[model samples]
Target: MGKKDVSISDSIYDRIKERVEGTGFDSVDEYVEYVLREVVEEEEEEEEPYTEEDEEKVKERLRALGYMD
Candidate 1:
């Protein structure tokens, strides 16, 4: 993977390092990337949350149209 050196404050680096100690991450860089990617994936999956009620409505409609029993 391509990498670029990012400038972070010593305090911020220390914070990440502390978390890294017990997280099983090999390095601070890996932990940071994992967190960033998690945030991105969460945003991508952000949409209407389907529920059982919604599913039942569709099934009811299909039954009404003789598409299902």
Candidate 2:
């Protein structure tokens, strides 16, 4: 994919630059991509919605495994 130009605040940009130096990432794009991946994974985790049937299945499994009262 072609690169995109982005503008960020000086403080946030400095922090990304500092982290990139320790992480061996040579460019702002690379560091931003890594941070974006982390954010996406976190969002995916938050978006996992459990239905009523899913909760029931978990309760049954826990009972079968003797983890429930």
Candidate 3:
């Protein structure tokens, strides 16, 4: 596999190092890979929050359909 070097803050690097040791990962690269995978999973699972505007639209549709009195 190919590798790429990226720059990060000292604090972030330190935190990733800590996680690498704490999780018994062999290298910082492994820890970084795990973190990036988690971030992508979280982004995929995230959805827009429900809002009053959506509720109002649904209510209007229901009224138009005579489902509401």
lDDT pick, better of 2 and 3: 2
Model 2: lowest-lDDT 10 consecutive positions: 60-69
Q: Runs in model 2 with CA error above 4 Å?
A: 47-69
Q: TM-score for all predictions? A: 0.61, 0.50, 0.50
Count of residue pairs whose backbone atoms collide, per candidate: 0, 0, 0
The residue-level lDDT of candidate 3 at 5 comes to 88
Model 3: residue 26 alpha-carbon error in angstroms: 1.1
In candidate 3, position 23 carries an lDDT of 47
lDDT of 2: 0.73
lDDT of 2 by residue, 1-69 (tens): 776777899999987777566445678778798668767976887777768997798788556534576
Across 1-69, the per-residue lDDT of candidate 1 in tens digits comes to 788877889999998898677445789999788778867966886795648997798688556534588
Candidate lDDT (C-alpha), each: 0.76, 0.73, 0.72
lDDT of 3 by residue, 1-69 (tens): 888887889999897787556344688877688668757966885785548997788688556534576
Candidate achieving the largest lDDT? 1
Off by over 4 Å in 1: 48-69
Model 3 segments beyond 4 Å from truth?
Answer: 47-69
